[model samples]
Each structure stands twice: as structure tokens, then as C-alpha cells.
Target chain A: MDRVPILKAGDVLLVSIQTDLEDRTVMALREDLAERIVRTGARGVVIDITAVEIVDSFIGQMLAGIAAMSQLLDARTVVVGMRPAVAITLVELGLSLGGVQTALDLETGLRLLGAGPLDGGPSEAQDRR
Target chain B: MTTQPGEQTHIVELLRSRRETALDRWTELAGAELRGRLSRGELRGELDDLLSLMLRALDGPDAEAAHDELTAALSEMSRRRARQAFTPTETAFGVFALKQVVYELVTESGSNRPRLTEELMAFSHTVDELGLLTFETYAATREQVISDQAEQLLELSTPVVKLWEGIVAVPLVGTLDSARTQVVMETLLQTLVDTGSLYAVIDITGVAAVDTEVAQHLMKTIKAARLMGAECVISGIRPQIAQTMVALGIEFGDIVSKASLADALEYLLARSGVRIVREEAG
Candidate 1:
């Protein structure tokens, strides 16, 4: 029953959560995501799941869905902090993350918010919730 | 029924001037038509032809004539795009329209055997979807170049259970280019807000190359995730990417990097204090 915490960092939005990805967790995330996305008026949003053991199909789809929705709301979204088990299982299942952007960390993902990485790197992090 | 010459002419003028709206409209509508045709078989013959042309272009020397033709078509389409306005769905349909046209032509020609008059029909059935997809036409194809990338991606990526909602894991397996990165960026953000997961993980172990663009994209995702109160975890740090980062003089602070998925899982398990029995070899 661990819930993910949503935060607004400087020029970026952060969503941090511990493992155990279930339906309630997902429902919590989806509530009013659009307004928060546009409120930033900045550029990017990062979803950090550094601590998660089991990321099933539902969670995967929901993440993808969130990323998709974020784009329309005027902000870029990145899915960071994936463990090996989740990566392997997602791949084996033939899941297509057709439209979601992904990165290794929050800092790197935020830099992605720039105009398509055309201006090189400004600088960047991993912190657990 | 709604083709407007005067309006289209104005759009043509706008496209020549590099108007974003007009260009987007033309691409969307045309692209949508291509999509429908490819999915429904209206442009089957054209699809086959285009695929073979792509193959020929790749295998042999450059097909300047074909290149010119494609460029002209794309340019013409852009002019059209500049003339019309489309919703997201319509724009998607337009992109699909263009996609189907090229796919139908390329695939059809690749499979058809000129020597087999007796089995013309049989050849038709066997070779339609058998050829390789190129990046020249579809930008997404370029991102899928790594031999096992997509195969690996499918397994590692979380399924779209909620379509536009949920925690999705994307294990980036290959090079990240501008075109592919754009798609990834948009999709991930939209997905995040829709599903609103606080945790979205991106594992990049199989990526063969990482440039400034890739690193920056990672940054962008992190930025966007934060706005929605989501946490982004990066698990894979291949030796090469690290090397590339150093070479590029990029600085990543406290970025999560695990040697493998098992290591990452252990980290996650530790967080939740959920212990499972590991098989002990006798």
C-alpha cells in the first residue's frame, strides 16, 4: 500500500515512489495529472521508481499512458529508474512502449526537455522517496 | 469532399514560407490516409512497390531518381499539410496515410516474383509483409535498427494496460537519435500524466551508443517526470555509455545505475522489505 509521492522541483516535476506497483498506486498517480503537467509551464517531468521489485503489465501500460497524456498537456515526460527484472520481463512480454521517453536518471531526463538536445548538456540525480 | 483549392493554394504559399500549422495539417491528413490504407489494404500495391524501392535503395547504390521522387512527394505533402488544420487523431491518421502508401508499395514489390507466373497469387500471399522497414520514410524505423533492440524492448517494456495510463518501463536497447528521441519523449510524458505513476523506470543496458542527444533526452524525461511528481529511475549503465558520457564531458549526479535487472530488483525488494526464497543449489 505504499503510495507514490508527486513533487514540483525547480523547472521540473518529480514523482517518486517505492516498489510494490499495484492498482491503487496507479489510481493515485492518474488523478488530475493534466493540470499538474501544464502548471509547470517549464519543460519536463520525471517519474522515479528507483525502488520497485515488481512492475507488472498494468503499471507498464499506465506509465505509458501518462507519458502520452503529458505530451498533450504541454510538457515532456521521462520514465527513469528501472531495475533489471522489470526491463527483462517487459521485453519478453513483447510490450511496445510506442510513445514514451525513457532515461537512466532524473537529471539526464530533464536535460531532454531542452529543444531536442540540440544545445548539449547543462548538468544533472538519483534520490529515493 | 473537403479539398479546397483556394485554401490549399494559400497553404501552399504558407508552407513555402515555412508555416508550422500548414505543414502539420498536410502531414497529418496525408499521413492518416496512408495509415488507413496500409491497415485496410487499399494501397496494397503501392505499399509493396515502396518497400521494394526501399530495399533496392539500401542494397544497391543510391536511387537518385527515387530519392528525388520521394523528396518531391514529401515536399508536396508538406505544402498540403500547410493548408489544413487537423486534430491529433487526424494528424495521426495523416501520418498513417503516408505510412501505408510507402509500406504497401515496398512490401508488395519485395515479395512479388516476376518469374513465377504460375504462382503469382501464391507469391503475393507470401511476400507482402516480409521485407525490411527503412528509416528514410518512417523516422521510427531508425530507432529500431539494433538487431535485437525491438525484440529486447518488447520484453522489458511494460505493457499499455491502460492505454494512456500506468507505470511503463522502457529498456532503451540501441542508439537514441533526434527523431526517435522525439517520439519517446512525447509518448512517455503523455503516458505519465494519463496514468500518473510516481515511478517510471528506464533501463538502458543494451544501448550500443549514447550521444549528447541521448543524455539530454534522459534529462528532459527527468524534468518532466518531476513536474508530475513522478520519480524516474535509470538502472542500466553499460560500460560504453559511461565511457561516452565521460568522453562527452557530461555530468550525471546521483543517477541510479545498476549492472543488471537483478541488481535493480534487489534494490526495489530491499525498499519494500519483501524477501523471496532464492533457489539454493544442492
Candidate 2:
């Protein structure tokens, strides 16, 4: 399935990470999706990784790379929905996504993407085709 | 406070045997340095005198060995130590004993002294790297090195050793470096050619990471297995690996990555009509 982790709102691709994102997979996803998000002219992008179980140095670097790439595409990026296990692993492995935006949940993630609160929630954004 | 006397005696006996070997090597090395030109003779007297003096020195201080030839061997060792920048410390005895070994080999008539010293030094280094300063330490290190060697052998061991024909399993674990990969492929290919195993399982469940290079190597291994009339099964792919494979777009044209070793075993057993007795769950 051609799944891009980023979603766009008025040119912003608000991405929701659905699986464990390591370096290779994340790079694959980013290369596949970054152009699409940029072309849409999204103001800011949000990445939701609540479902992820680990965030090693490789994944952290990918996020930072994606965030920088998104900004060059004229969109600020926010990473939201980080699981505690992922955070702990990231810290223990000495990793960080320096300068990447972060939020507690999709609501904040969506807000950081320059979209106001949805009438429903991320379920609504996910529900859209 | 309860100790098994059996275990203690076993250790003592092991040490005794090890000491005998070390002492042999030690004497042989030390004797090499004192070798002087012999004009076509057994030259047994010089060897006997040196061995007697060494044994006495080892047993306790013997007030002798004013022999000019023996002292020359000792000086040669000191020169080597000085060249290697080794100070004569307490540990120098170990070095001294070893140097004496090389010296003896070198001084022996009809012996290429330089080559013998090189061999002995390499052997000495191997012993040190094996983490045993003395032969007695070999009890544990030797066992460990043997297991490490066992692991190495598995990497080199052929998947196909035919009892009659048609049975093979290659269990892979740890890191798969190129050398190991080469060994594994050779073993598997040779086995497939020999036994003509109808079913071969290359179970990689024990492997933690399945990168693209490894995944490609697996493909090559599978292809080679097929050329020899063997069907290959790759077992033990966890969820993460499955996801990675999907992301990497690794097409399983023919090779099957099953769940576990047991699953692969069951699959093979079913094909071969070997019924497995299932133990009732607790």
C-alpha cells in the first residue's frame, strides 16, 4: 500500500506514524511522501507517532531530516503522539530530534500544523480519503 | 561450606596435566636459543645438560650452569627483550621462560633459528590472546575458545551431510559477515550437491537484524539451494522484520519465511511423515 505518514492541510501534510519507524523505513516513507506534502503548499506538517514502540538514533535523525526537508518545502513540522517506550529508548540510546516540533496528541499536532481543532479529532482526518 | 571433593580433584588433575605440557613447551623453547654448530653428531650431551639445569632451576635455585653456550642463549634473549623494549619485571619471567624457548630452538644445530622463533612467538601470542597465561588457565579458556570455534565451525559446516541422502538443516545465528556468509553458502551448496536434500531449511529466526544486504544474501543462498534440487525455507521472521521486508519490497519469489524453528520443523516433518509427539500444556 502507498501510505505517506504526512497529511496536508492547506499545503501542510500532517503525518501520523502508524508503525515502528526505523531509519530505513522512515527514509523510504519520507522520500515517498515529502514531495507530495511540499507540492500541496502545506503551511506546517505534523507527524504523529503514538503507535511507535521505539525511536533509536536512526529514527531520530530521519525525523529531523524530514522536518528540515518539510521546512524547505515551506512548511513547519510538528511531531506528536510519541509513546513513552519510544521516548525512553531514544534517551537511553542518546538520541533526539533537535528542532522538530512536538505535541501530546493529534489535536495539538493538528494545531501545530496550522489547522484548528477538528469538530471531531484525528479520527476525522484519518477518516478522510 | 560444603564443597564437592570430586570437583576439586578434577581441577587438580587438570592442572597437573596442563603443567606438564607447559613445562615441555617451556623447555623446548629455552633449549632452542642455546643451539651451537654441531659437525654431524647427535649433540645429546649439550641438550641433556641444559634440560637438567633448567629442571633444577625450576625445582629450586641450582648453584650452577656456568656453561658459556647457555649464557649466550640467555644474552640473546635479553637482547630480544631489550629490542622489544620489555623491561625485566615480575611478568618478565613469563617472557624470560618463553624467550628461553625461542633461543633453544635457534641454537639447535640444523635448525633455522629465526623461523622457529617466529613460530614460537606466534604460538605464544595465540596462547595469550586465548586469555591463558599458563596452560592451567586453558581449562576454562580452552573450553570457551572451543565453543567459539564450534560457532565458527557451524559457519563453515555444510548443511548437507548425507546419512543416506535427503535431510538438511542450517541454523544461522549471530552476525553474518561476508566470510561467514561465504562459509555458509559453501557448506549449503556442497551439502545440497552431496545429499541432494529434497528439503533444506535455512532458519534465520535467531538472527536479530535482517538488513538489505543480508536479505539479498539469503536470496542468493535460496537460489543456490534450488539449483541442487533442494527446496529452502527461511524460518523465524518476527513482526518488525516482516515490516522491514515489506518496506524494502523484498519479493518472496519462492523462498518462504515461516514463523519459528518449530513451525519449520513441523512443516518438514509433515512432508516427511515424521509424527511429532505433542506434550500436553500445563
Candidate 3:
């Protein structure tokens, strides 16, 4: 019955996964994210997973899937705030998220999306968004 | 007290009364073992202090009660000698030489002739215990020294430095092992987070050889850094290492590898949008 919240800031969709996601929850999030991207026409997505620990292969695959899906929807997905231990675990598990772009934190992720071709030079991009 | 409270008390009384003779004689014997490593005058002071402690332990109303203090004093003495770089045999000889001092005193005096054999036997056991304690302490101190040097070597092998803003570099030397790999990963990750660097360069120019296991460890480190949202660039690929990697069928995949540190830095700077230009001088 519980689901992650997706908020829109300008053309980007910010999804903050603050809880440990179950398999069902992950599926729900994937579907929910796709619907929101369609409804809002969001060009960028930043999924903040700083609070999530112990990312198993299932979760890693789900994240990679989300990034791929977002790409198809014309949205750039940047997963941010991955803890060091989780990264080491993922690497040891041999599940390097090859296609996904990552940023240090949410602010950096947002800056990356905005600085690239999606948004124009500073002031004008701000006004248009 | 009149019943003679064991061997320890009898030995203590003899040592206390014959203190100067025991010290002088022990000094002479121990000096022979020292081989001029320590001056006789300096050795005499150490022998004097140790003799007094032994005498006190023997003179105690409950000699066994002084057992702990005596062991502590002996252990400290052995540690000091070890730190002074004395050999194990040299240290043991220092304690063993006192046995000769006591033996002579016990044998030369004819008053205790009736109990001479038993007294000499007990005294020999006590001196043997002291020698054993010294050898144990010497071994422990030597092990401590070796482990400390190992820790220092581990630290010296891996050094992480901040190359530029949002860029840090680790120039690795020596062979890579699991232990050193753990240090490398922890330090590199911590540095990446501390500096908030977007890029990292791991230059393995100093690494002696490249094998599959070493390659796997390097990949793990790089992947861990990427999890922290920092890209890793490996530089310093010597010809031998390159050939080894090829012959071993090691595939780095998408991970960027450079021929040298300078080239790696150039690649990093170019990606970060930093330009470098040289001006012509007159």
C-alpha cells in the first residue's frame, strides 16, 4: 500500500527513495516513475538513494532498468547519493551499472542535468523552465 | 621466620649481604658476554639495579608475593635491552651470569655445607626461570618491532594526493596484495568524498607486475570510486605491464587507461574543462 513520492521541479522529476525497497515496491516505483514522466513530460530524472543501503543484484538491475526506461522516454536519469559500502558490495557482486550516469549528490545531479544540452544557458533556461 | 621461609628467602638474604660482591662478579661475567657492546661501568649500573630487585624479592616475608613485581621488572629490563638492540643470547647471558655469582657464593662458603646441595639446586632453578622470562620478553619485543615496521611499510606503499580540484591521484608502488588493496580502496574512497572530487587517477607506474587478480582488485577500487560518483582514470601503463595485461587476456572494458601520469592528467584536465597553454619566451 506504500509507494515512493515523485515531485516535479521545472522539467525534472525528483524521486527520493528514503526507505528500503521491497521487490514489489521496486516494481511499483518503476511503473509510477514511467507514468509520471509521461504525464509531466519531464526531461530529467534524479533518483536520490542516499538512505538506501544493501543494494543487491535485484535492486541493481531495477536501477539499470529504470535508467534505460527513462532514456527511452527522453529523460536522463542520474542516480545519486550511493553510499561507499553499497558501491563496494555492488562491485564485488559484479553488477556495475554501466549505462547509468551517477552524481555525488542531489545538487550535483541537478546541476549536471541543467548544464547539459537539455537546458539553455543559465538565465534563459531558468525562465523557460 | 626462623624456620627459613623456602628457597627464595634464603637466596634473598645471601644476595642482600653479598650485594657488592654479586654485582661486581656478575658485572665481570656479563661484560665478557657483552663483547664490548656495552661499557662495563654502564653494565654495572644495570646489573646492580637488577641484583637489588632480586634480593628484595628473596628477602620478602612472603617471597611469592613479590613474584609479580619481579617478573614485571625482568620484563622491563629485557624490553629495554631489546630496544637497545641487544641480541637474545646477550640478554639471556646478563641474567645467566648472576647464576655464576650465586653459585660461587654458595660453594665458596663452608658454613652451609650440610644444606649446600639443596640450596644450590633451588638457586639454579630460580636463575633458570629468570633466564626464561628474559628470552620470552626479548622475543615479544622483537615481534612488536617487526609488526611496527610492517605497518609503516603499508602506509608508505600507498599515498593519495589531491592533483586538482575535484581530482585526486594515488601513485601506487610495490606489489598489490589483498591487505594493501583494502588500504588503497578505503583511502581512495575517503579522499574522494572529502574533496568531493569528480575524478580520480590511479597511476600504477610503480607497480611491478600486472596479473588477473591485480586487475580485478584495481577494477573493484575503480568501481567503488564510481559508486561515490567519481570517475577513475588509470595511468602509468609501462610496456611490460601492457604486454602482461594483453597476454593474460585482461580486459579493462570501458575504464580509461593512459600510457603515463602526464597523459592521464592531460585527459582529466581536458574533461574537466581546464585549459593549459604555454607562452613563448624572448
Candidate 4:
């Protein structure tokens, strides 16, 4: 199983998944993300799936689970770069990721996290935290 | 009744003797029925070719092969007529008219009346088979045309246009069905990804009516777009559609719906932090 790499930028943790996520990989990602959120004391987490082309119910649940877990750790989770097809499939599958924040791309994800573009000042994400 | 070889030759000879007369009479009959939809000369040409083919089929040594060739020719003519929007009656009459011409020629000859009547019956049977074949082909061709038109309409109806740098709009202009809604959803979602548009406005000004099913489809589409991190605004709700939706107890929830496309665009622009100001002309 390939391990998903999690990169830390300032107070945000960025996880750019570049491969097909298997069940074990998702579980590992969830555990690893929870651990890193506490260790780095990050206020935001951005999961970039621009390269992910396929997803199943397991992965959908994992995303919502990650968002919920991060919130408990005093962190906001934003899933970004979701392909239109994937988003549609998730919606059809009755998993809208209701509690998870979404962005169009990594830049927007970072901005949503209030970790990019200081010119816009602190975003609502920062104010809430 | 099967046509005897001797009777077949006799009828073939009679037709060969007066081919021109038979063709002229057949063309006149068919032309009158068509009522100038096809030129007289063009109808004569078609009948001339068919008469020669029929003669060859009766006179040819390989009866089976010649008959198949004649059927193919009839099918080809039927397909052409079908495409020209000729009614099934008009097309079958073109073949059936030949039977009348051959009967006239047989009676005018007046040599072997009894035997000739038997041969005429066989020839009439062949013409009936040919006429029925033409009818079947015409119906099949008409069905093919209808299905092709339906496919074309499906492709032509849905169009996603970029309304602004970060906005796209789908102008729906017909009755909404499941198939069309699926197409609209896919196209709008794909456009959103391609343009990275943060806003989508579904303009339904041209849509004739809205029912619960259409409302459900719209809600599903809006939810899908929102899942992709884009906001969707439903616009151009005519008063009747609004009343119908309310009467049906359809709730749009917190989704921003505006009366006109202009309102939707204005709302999206404001949400995107773009301020529109009036500039005085100097």
C-alpha cells in the first residue's frame, strides 16, 4: 500500500493525494492526519484530490470523517480540487460531505484556510477558529 | 399459385412486346396519384427501370437470383420515397399500378384469354409481394428517421455558455425529462470544472412548464454543483411556474433564486466581491 504524504505549510496541513486510495490507505490517512493535526498544532487541513479520478463510498465516508475529526482537534478541514465527475458520483451516492468545506483548487483551499494571500485579510475560517 | 415456366415466358413476351405502352400507362397512373410531387419525366424514368428489371426477372434463366435483384431494386426505391416523405399509400401504389398495366396489356392482346388469366394471377401475386415489401421498408425507414431526429434534438437542446469569467449559465428551452436533465447536469458540471466558475445560473425562461419531477431534477443538479464547491442560482422563474412550485409544496430551501437572469448575475457578482458602479457619460 502506498502511503499518502501530508505536507505542512505554516499553520495548515496539506495532503495532496496522487494515487488511487485503497481501504488501508484511507485508514492510514485518517490516523496519520489526526496525529499530525495535534503534533503540528495546525489550525487548518487541506486535502487536494485534483489527481484522484475514482472514489467509492469508503473514500466518501473517510472525507467526512476527516473533516469531523479535524474539527474536534481544533482544526478546519477543506477538501479541494474535486473533479466534477467525482463530485457528481458522491452526490448521487447520497454523500454530500455535508460538514466538510470544499474549494475549487489548492490556492482557493489555502485561501479558505486563511493560510494564503494576506491581502484578503483573515478569512471567515480564521475568524471562526 | 406458382407461375409455370411456359406461362412465365408467355407473359414476359407480352410485356416485352408493349414495354413502352405499359410504362407510359403505369407512369401516368402513378403520377396522378403523386399530384406533381414528382415530375412526370422522373416518374417515367423510374417506371422504365422497374419494367426492365421485372421483364428480366421473368425471362432470366436464374429465376431465384433475378427475383432477388428485383426485390432489392424495389427496396431501394421504397427507401428513397420514404426519405422524400412520400406516404406509404403513394409508394405502394407505384408498384401496384404495374399490375393494372399488365392486366390491360394481357386483355388487349386477346390471344389465350383463359391461360393468360392464370398467368396474370401469378404476375399479380408477384406485384402484391413487391408492394408489401415496399410498404415494410417504408415503415422501417420512417421509424429510423424519427429516432435519428430524436437523437439530434437531444444533442442540440443543451448548451452551457460562460456568463462571466467565473460564472456559467445553462439556458434550458424545452420540457424537462430524465434523459435531458441528465445531459444538462453533466454538461453544467463539466463546464463548471473547465471554467472554474464559482457561480452557475440555471435560466429557465424558455422552459414551458415545471412539475415536481423537474423541480427534483433541479434540486439534484444544484446539490451536485454545490458539492463541487460552486454556488448555483436558479433564475427566470415566471409567475405561473412559481405558483405551480409553491402549490406543489416544492421548497428551494436556502438556494438563492432570482426573478430574472440579471438578478442572478447581480447576486453572483456581489457574492464574488465585484462591485458594479454607474459611470456618467461625458
Q: Pick the candidate with the highest DockQ.
A: 3
Q: Looking at candidate 2, what is the lDDT of residue B117? A: 46
Best lDDT among the predictions, by candidate number? 4
Q: Assess each prediction's global lDDT (C-alpha) against the native.
A: 0.52, 0.55, 0.83, 0.86
Assess candidate 3 and give its TM-score to the true structure. 0.87
State, as a TM-score between 0 and 1, how close model 2 is to the true structure. Answer: 0.33
User: Per-prediction TM-score, chain A only?
Assistant: 0.78, 0.78, 0.88, 0.91
Local accuracy of candidate 3 as per-residue lDDT tens digits, B40-131: 89889877777766665666565565666678888998998898889899899989988788878776654565666776667677778889
Candidate 2 stretches greater than 4 Å from native? A1-129, B1-165, B266-282
The list of candidate 1 runs beyond 4 A from truth reads A1-129, B1-167, B272-282
TM-score per model over all chains = 0.31, 0.33, 0.87, 0.88
What is the C-alpha lDDT profile of model 1 across A1-51, one tens digit per residue?
555677876666778766677888787786645667666574667777667
Candidate 2 clash figure, as a count:
23
In the order shown, the candidates' DockQ scores are: 0.02, 0.01, 0.45, 0.41
Give candidate 2's chain B TM-score.
0.44
* Candidate 1 to truth, TM: 0.31
| Shift in Å, residue B193, candidate 4 | 1.3
